[model samples]
Target: MTTGDRCEMPPIPLRSTPIKGFILDITGVLYNSMEGTDGIPIQGSAHAVNRLYSESRVRFLSNESTGTVGHVVGKLGRLGYTGIREEDVITPAPTAAEYCKRNGLRPHLLVHPGIRSVFDGLSQEDPNCVLIGDAEHAFTFKAINTAFRHLMKMKDPLLLSLGCGKFYQRTDGPCIDVGAFAEALKYSSGCRHVVIGKPRGDYFQTALDSMGLAKDEVVMIGDDIVSDVGGAMAFGMRAIQVRTGKWRSEWESHEIKPTLIADDLLSAVKACID
Candidate 1:
């Protein structure tokens, strides 16, 4: 947050329990989302992460529903990161698609076109489900109305929401996230949407599994206090909130407090290992 590419944050104190794995949030935690379809890496974050790679396993758990798993890995490398692996990255799109396949539900997908391919094999012939993600500008009135009609008319309505965070940070400014649109649909259709991404215990468990660590042996580092800190705590794991990305001062008073709060990722990494 100090400015430019690098941060000037100092190392922080640590907790007694040893943390062997990390679940990281991409957008606001690692870098500031910018134009050109990628983002800028936050100061010292790349270095801190690389250093952590020497000590512990890392899994990038993001509700960033846009890219394929490979693209997620590429995005990290393009942002100057070196320690992340393809399987270490977990996004909601593919996971949601797998859910649809497992449940035999054909989703009237309201997701971004970028990740729309993941649901390719599934039958959208008679979409009994409505799966929503960060569709950005694609959430037209017609689109929502169409999806609403699907849910209202279905014998059993199923709405799978990718993640429910209200908004995320971009270099220019803040923009509405998937949760806002998902809520609107829920209110209009009177159908409850199932959460598919962060804060969801199963999703956290998936990330935890990828790390081969139990909940107590891992730490969740992210920006959104609700989905990241609150969710991780609810899953019985320690969580750390960084004052970057979509971070707001008002959230500091939120009911769910982080195990520790830091200025940015650099300090969070230091605290993770200290």
Candidate 2:
């Protein structure tokens, strides 16, 4: 479908066609915090997920750069989500690793230690490419300067950003995401960084390809209007926006629209199934 073919917050039907596959965002749609410390499920989210798990191919797509696929799976398990495996989760670390391997670029990683294992086989000797992610405590000025120096030496070095999210809701409050840093480097280095997660066509395409389903056959459910909803819509997939995490009133003014808008993930899934 084209960008003009948008469905704006349509009412949920009594019975709709069962979706073949589902692309779910973890941060807001599935759970609240990264640590899964928030008490209880978001109303009926658990029930909806459990029901869909039996019938549809579900994949958890996250922009979280601090953890590996295994780490995310473990967190989900702790939050009482059953039947989830490592393969069911897709994060930017693996995608970045694959991109670097395919292009024969040596990586200078600026990501969290938790996800460092994703690039295990890759060479880091003469690091020609600088890969940036949400390194949290490790994202010091020294680290950024170090990466900048490495980029200056190469004629056209690669800069890979895991996600370009402006900020994320942490346990305490909202915190800066990798996008800010990525933009800074882009301005300084004059190198356009290739974003590997959310809102990027290739990122959504990767998830769809893994499920072996066409874009039209799948639906993307998430809270971020730009990355999750707008990105999926741009990729020709139906999207549902949940009013949870980083949702704002100004999202309605954006050019890209969601097929439906639900109160939360449970409501969004209910719109999908019923």
Candidate 3:
């Protein structure tokens, strides 16, 4: 279907922020569970992102920390998104790495072994901070307690969370995410954390910096109003909420509303560009 065939909502008159490019969320907005459905093109929902990219650079920002940038690029390519590159993708792990590098703060990282190899020039002793992201073993109380105890001793140690949902919905049921673990640490250790994903301004800041745009010119699109809309609005960017993935009937009652809402990505894009 063409752009006209898709949009169900009228595009609001945007005041125009410095967001000449776009910063996109991956999980619910791009793909679900990092897997591609049969016959579904990666580009299927990417029309608006591509349209903006044609005129401006589009960065495929994600919070997945389980794998390296190559893993993310491969997944996107398999889903039919051809524009993503290694540098375009950002995750909490990498963001933490960069933050450490720039600030000259080396922290002991607790990442999944798969992506642990990506950390360079860091060691286990006397680290400046404790960086936590997604880990296959992260759910265990033993793991959490161990990390928490170490954090308690550090002076002003910061917990950095890559984009992880507070709860994840799967075939079996809902489950806690690394953020909950981080929260537990906060409660116990009394150390503050900086989240680097949806619902947090830090993640948006990273995306905006990557896109080289101020908050106003960029548009935030996602399937979840809480993360996508709320997060984007917190950063002063226009937001479009898509009624897919995490969309439910009660979202209309939310205290914070999107600039516009649509049935799907196509409609959301139309609402933005039209």
Best by lDDT: 1
Query: Can you tell me which runs of candidate 1 are displaced by over 4 Å?
Result: 1-14
Best-performing candidate as measured by TM-score: 1
lDDT of 2 by residue, 1-274 (tens): 2335565443332234447888999886777664446423456777778877887777878898988888888877877776778887889889989999999989898888889888999999989889999998898999998988888877886799998998876546677889999888888888758999998988888888889988777888988888898888778778888887777767765666678878988788777776
**Steric collisions counted per model:** 1, 0, 7
Q: What 10-residue stretch in candidate 2 is worst by lDDT?
A: 8-17
What is candidate 3's lDDT per residue for 1-274, written digit by digit as tens?
Answer: 1233544342334444344666666665665552223224323576655775676666665666777888777877877777767788877677677777777766666667757766776565777677777775655777777777778878877777666466543323444566666777788888878776677787787777877777777877776666678777777778876766566668765666677777766676665565
Between prediction 2 and prediction 3, the one with superior TM-score is 2
Q: Tell me the TM-score of model 1.
A: 0.93
True-structure lDDT of candidate 2: 0.81
lDDT of 1 by residue, 1-274 (tens): 2234543231222464788888999889889998677888899899878877887888889998877888878888888886688878899888898898898889998888889889899999888899998888888999888989999998878799999989999999998899998888888888867999989999999998877899888889999998998888889888899999999888766666678888999899997776
After superposing candidate 3 on the true structure, give the runs of residues whose Cα lies further than 4 Å from its correct spot: 1-19, 34-43, 46-49, 168-175, 200-202
TM-scores for all predictions:
0.93, 0.90, 0.81
